[model samples]
Target: MGRAHVSTHQSVGGRYRLVEITRRETNSVRWYADDLRTGRPCLVTRIGLPEEPDGAAHRAPARVLRTTESVARLCPGRIATVVDALDEDGSLWTVTAWIDGTPLGEVLAEQGTLNYVRAARIALELLDVLDAAHAEGITHGELSPGQVFVREGGPVVVTGYGLAGSTTAPRLTAPSYAAPEQARDERAGPAADLWALGALLYTMLEGRPPFRDRGRPEATLKGVDRLPLRTPVRAGPLARVVQGLLRKDPRERLTRQVVREVLTRVLSEDSGAVAEAVPSPRLRGGPALALRCADRRWSGRTTVLGTTLAVVTVTVAVLAATQSLPGTGSAADAPAASASAPGDRGASRPPAAPAPSPSGTADLPPGYRTYRAPEGFSLALPAGWQRLDTSRGADLAYRVTFGAEGDPRTLAVTYSTGVGSDAVAVWRDDVEPRLERSGDYERIGSIRSTTYQGREAADMEWYAEAGGSRVRTFGRGFLLGGGRGFSLRWTTPDAAWEDGASREALRTFLRTFRPAAG
Candidate 1:
């Protein structure tokens, strides 16, 4: 959902230097990256979360890490182990041990319809992982061909395990595979995963989804919700089982036990249908390890649908989901959905005193100084404030946040290279949709068209809950011409908004900010 534009050859978090664009989807991208600290290769994914108004962002990374670790322990070799989950700029960057396999989607592209026996074997393995998760009351929420990786020798590894329910987006990456319930924006449950399992199986055997992706996630989801599934011609013995899983009603979808039985029966009965297991191709004479499809050619068939929301909206949602910024609501109660979008970054720099302003810092508030960023922006900050986090998107949009430990307030500055010309329209068309989807978002007033430092701008204020406390945020965004724009977001606890210091801080930031020279 963040800008669909990350450049290759940049380092993420100053550690994972992206070397190649492995794969791209509607809202996410895969990278072949090198871990600078350990000299190891890793697979990193960037996913745009729903924009919330409160503490959702602060809690997201921990949730992702905890869920991933728990599931990895439950299903050892079958799950991709997460190395780190970070909230950067406005995206979640999840790093995992490099996987040595081709994405199932890529495999499908290379070898269209898979043999039923092979598909069954893969399904059983997937079910094994799902069974372990379901037994612990965890639902995958998002299961699609893109999330599954197949080794040349047939071992399947699943990624994006802890991503369900991470954001408010109904189905982040693959809308065609979303269950009828998810497509309708209802709470997703284990049944949703079953539907996706059926969809994946259908795709494996039919060379396409039961409901094709019709360019827009909402449209595709509508099809999943309302359209009768096409009859499977190549599913063979798997047809009935696949159909059972894809039932429109969640209560009617086949249960895991029944699915397991059907898949096991197929494997047992059609012994000759599976290709004989072969040795995995070796990488440097060791186990053949490849980042998920890093070596494969980019496929035009698999981009994020064009009807997806704008990048600014995605970044706003991610910032809300990851930063726990005031006015962004919590995602604690949202059900897991799917993982299917974009890039991530989380690098922190030590606190440093702001550089002396050419215009003189003598007039600044007590204990405040000017901090000049290497990113070409500058602003006044409280004495102890420093760069706390930074994030980047595929479209080259980035956000930098500044704060001090023990301080609940945060100032985020976001720059986007792909923005519309009108500031009010940007907020209404690009931003408001995302905020409305966030929990407990209440706008204080109409979006006000204004001017800042001689540039046309718009301001919006809203309130939401963050960690059991009501919080508020005021944001101002302006155009810099040539499709470029920057936003200043300041968040504070609702109770503290009236504090003299907080009021002064907001004024200082707004009065002193200078965008990097173009």
Candidate 2:
């Protein structure tokens, strides 16, 4: 990367006044500038040119403006709106509307690492923009952390459009993020853009680019083309996504639709996605709106658990079952076995005081404590039990699991804002059928109508294999008005299902539970 020759308080083309250097990259610099003619703020980027003839350099301005105009129109708010592009001072300078957020690169530099959920949101945002651009036959070859701006309470804003084919150069900036084909100086295609998206995602989660900058463009490009890729440790559910997009062969890269599916699934697991949906797919009649969780209560709980994979797939299919589309609803997924140490939960909390039942007789066994969830629910959990996983869906539906290290039992609490008024029909018609598909699953008894806390509810018991171990689950689902409902699922190893400990825990959970203080 070359240092910018322009200083603060200078004017480029005598129309925009540069204020300060906002960001620097291996091949370009970004400046915060003001428009002399309009008095509005703008972002100006200056890139060092490849050794190309003047004829090619002169056309760079028109190419950048023209191509950016095409993409900005198609993506509207998702893309940076370029106001001008010009060749001057032996460099290419492009200016666009100022974004009111920090650069993705800067955010990572300061924070060091982001949890996978936040990264998933950003990844989905990037994927959506790429889907829009690729649909119009545009390729953003120069996708990098610096090209993306993350705004507060808004979607990400992507810049650096049209820079890929700006000149004979394979990539104009961020060579480390360039795809293998681009590094080899071969003609880059849409797959190259996907590779860059993977690299950007890798960098966000790992706090460093997949390929390192070797202090020279050619050397870094060489490593990108020739070196082995290190598998990411922090990607969690996103590991597959990163690998798929960063494949060496462009033709082998994941298609846009698949990437969107994986990215949206990761997003749906976040507590924040429920409040806001993935931006309506850019294309009309695109895939159904992905389930997003708006539960601010679990917003900070973003470490993706490997055990949640089963629940994520189920969450994606919940809408289909509700609509009688195909599959049925099954929240009876495997638990995150021993993922956390016992001390991680509230080991020091005193034993819960007796929860007086209508019969005037309820007491938590010793070593149990009352625990409250941010999602507006409370229950008595065995000592050392911690929240192990959470999966969310649209309309604020979510499932949270609790378990302790070395414990073969787990309690999962689910809340859904969308459901039918008849709880039995929900289990019999919409849920049980889906449970049948979860490997060696069998119903223990007929679905039974019941009552839970004065609400119409249903009970279903079943046995299924979870991670090679036979497991038993007792479930109770109850309905509230306006299509809202909640479910409590208590799972244990089938061997332990009839034991006194398992029975006592279930009774305490059901007896002491309290809904979000509504």
TM-score, per-candidate, Cα-based = 0.52, 0.53
lDDT of each: 0.64, 0.67
**Candidate 1, overall lDDT?**
0.64
lDDT of 1 by residue, 137-192 (tens): 88898788768988754357888776777777788777888899988889988889
Question: Candidate 2 lDDT, tens digit per residue, 301-374?
Answer: 34323234333321111111111111123443211111011111111111223433543224668988888788
Superposed by TM-score, candidate 2 places the C-alpha of residue 437 at a distance from the truth, in angstroms, of 70
Could you say which candidate leads in lDDT? 2
- List pairs with backbone clashes in candidate 2: 1-26, 273-292, 273-293, 274-292, 274-293, 274-294, 275-294, 376-516
Q: How many pairs of residues collide in each model?
A: 36, 8
